[model samples]
Target: MKRALSLLGYSIVGLTSVALGGCGQSGDAAPEATEVPKDFASSGPSAKAVESQFGTPVKDRVATIGLLNKRNNLTQDLVMKTGESRRVGNVIIKLANCERTLPWENPPEVGAFVQVFVEERASVQEKLAWHKVFSGWLFKDSPSLNTVEHPVYDVWVKDCAMKFPGEEEDPAAYASSSSAAKASGKASTAPAVAPAPSASPSAAPSPAPAAVPAE
Candidate 1:
């Protein structure tokens, strides 16, 4: 009898140990971050067209525009001219690069202008996840110490290509793969939510239905 009781106790301990082991294994395992589209190839020939048109380098993890010398607005304008543009959401972006001559007039600014197109009531808010621009100076001038790089321009280009037709500016067919990912259970990163439109008090509300005339 004593031997039987001891065997029963050992069996219970073994089962409990196995259950705890399984639970620990589950606790250690976590879902990996879903890999959305990273390489520019998914854009198909559209991205390739831009690369060939503007000579944008697609090496490394980012597309490099090389070094640009900021001379004046003229240099900046020249670079802007090289870009093939498209509208993303409410912003218009141009993809181009050039050697800007650092102007000697005022504070002597030397850098590239990754211009972000702003509509009447809209402008670039905070940094959101998207393609970004890469630029730097050739040492003729120095940017303010407080200045930090905002690759929003590149983000704009990729976003625009994915969302809107660059030549036509249609929003529906051209949206980014991120949109499709969101439709699936893949991309969960929420975009910046815009505010709701306000109604004017001058606009009167709809009238209630009149009381029934007949019973």
Candidate 2:
């Protein structure tokens, strides 16, 4: 009986030690942390080559973008120049370039090359961090061409303020020219009026020797 009791005690001690070792191993193991990028709002790809006739170089042009926050149903306009970035709340928007069709083009269009970053978690287990949600050219007229896919946000191009070579005609000059033409047309079409006779007595007097001569 003594031998059997001693063997049982030894077995219990070994099982308790193994269970504690397993717990220690699990406590030491941990998930690897994700490395966040230093540049959260990196620029998008380079813009396409544009001719001098196109007007406004890519870097000099300004672009307007619309940012919508679905959570609050609030939309805001973000006007930014090329190579610029703006942060609103936990989101960042970067503009690389913007473009528009020539004034004489048949189907006019405006677009902007943009990158969007949001501080959000990739998954439920992961912590919140800056992640690029979209990066590409977004068109104002044809929004379906490219879209920013995010659950809580939407971004679209509004306008690209740039001009073609002849687009910058002076408005004052145009108005003056139009007014002159209209005035000339009216003058040419008007009927001329004859002048009224003079009221002076010298012009109205006439001699009266006719009755005596008839007898």
Candidate 3:
């Protein structure tokens, strides 16, 4: 009985050590395998053509994405240009393209083609590694169309910043111009006052002239 108890205690300690070792894996570990295509994360040859009906080119467009970590209940906003990827904690998010409905379209919608990679193990026996867990278009108005089925993270599209051919001028530019105009108007309206002349010493009295005249 004593020998059996000792062996059991050693086995328990070994198992605990193994579990701790797996849990201590750092997120920076290189992934053993990546299912994403080589060109998937980049602006490949297919992206050379402009896809927007609006005048804004695809590469110039920007997108805002929301990332949530359910484990810690923390959320972060990722603003990125097309074909950009950002790594936060143990996950990497890549943006391929983002789009929105035309001004005339009914029921406007925004979307982005995103891929999410997380560093984790598939099972207890597997080593900690990177995995491409989600890849697809995430729609803002209609989220149920597709979803990120991760247990610890969630990603969604918030907005796509782009321009239509005749869309209104940029708000920032417009505000700056208005401020400049106001300044000019104030300057013009304010009356200018010339500087007053300084007082000068009076000329010497004509005493000499008067004395000569009297003499």
Candidate 4:
């Protein structure tokens, strides 16, 4: 009986030592940061493309996008503009440009060119790796046009908060133009004036012609 007990103790000690060694090896090698998508590094549009499309980049302009962390049931807005990128958790999102039709135009549409990178592990024990999961335009009104196909995340365009060339007018210029239009409208709407009374001499000549005919 004592011999069997001694053997069991030795087996427990060996298992403990193996567990400790594995822990030490894992601690020595830390996980690395996720890398950017290859497409973003290669084919992402440059600043010149922005200028060509938008005339000039509006530094203050921004596009707001909704990022859904389905794993956590959380949502956040990522505001960016042309040639801007944002990193959140295990995902990286970049905005190339955003567009919206004019208020007067029909079939209104709003869309944004977006790229998404997700960090994932090929297996449960492997380190996290990043890959481009989705890269294309997403629409605000029609999200079905394009989609992010990740099981853990979903991204959609919320709004593009940028001004177009003629979206707004200078305060002074607008006031002046408004006043001039009002003046023109008022003049066109003015009432007519009555004619002055006829002279007494014209009345006397009319009576004299009638008396001569009677005589």
Model 1 earns a TM-score of: 0.18
Estimate every model's Cα lDDT from 0 to 1: 0.34, 0.78, 0.79, 0.73
TM-score of 3: 0.57
List the candidates' TM-scores in order.
0.18, 0.57, 0.57, 0.54
Each prediction's RMSD to truth: 31.8, 11.4, 14.6, 7.8
- Answer with 3 or 4, whichever has the higher lDDT: 3
Candidate 4 global CA lDDT score = 0.73
Residue 169 displacement in candidate 3 (angstroms): 6.0
lDDT of 4 by residue, 26-90 (tens): 84444423334465545554423344354235445578999999988999998887667677767
Candidate 4 vs. true structure, TM-score: 0.54
* Higher-scoring candidate on TM-score, 1 or 3: 3
Q: Lowest summed lDDT over 10 consecutive residues: which window, candidate 4?
A: 191-200
Full-model lDDT, candidate 1: 0.34
- Write one digit per residue (lDDT tens) for candidate 3, span 146-190: 999999999999999987754575524644677899899888755
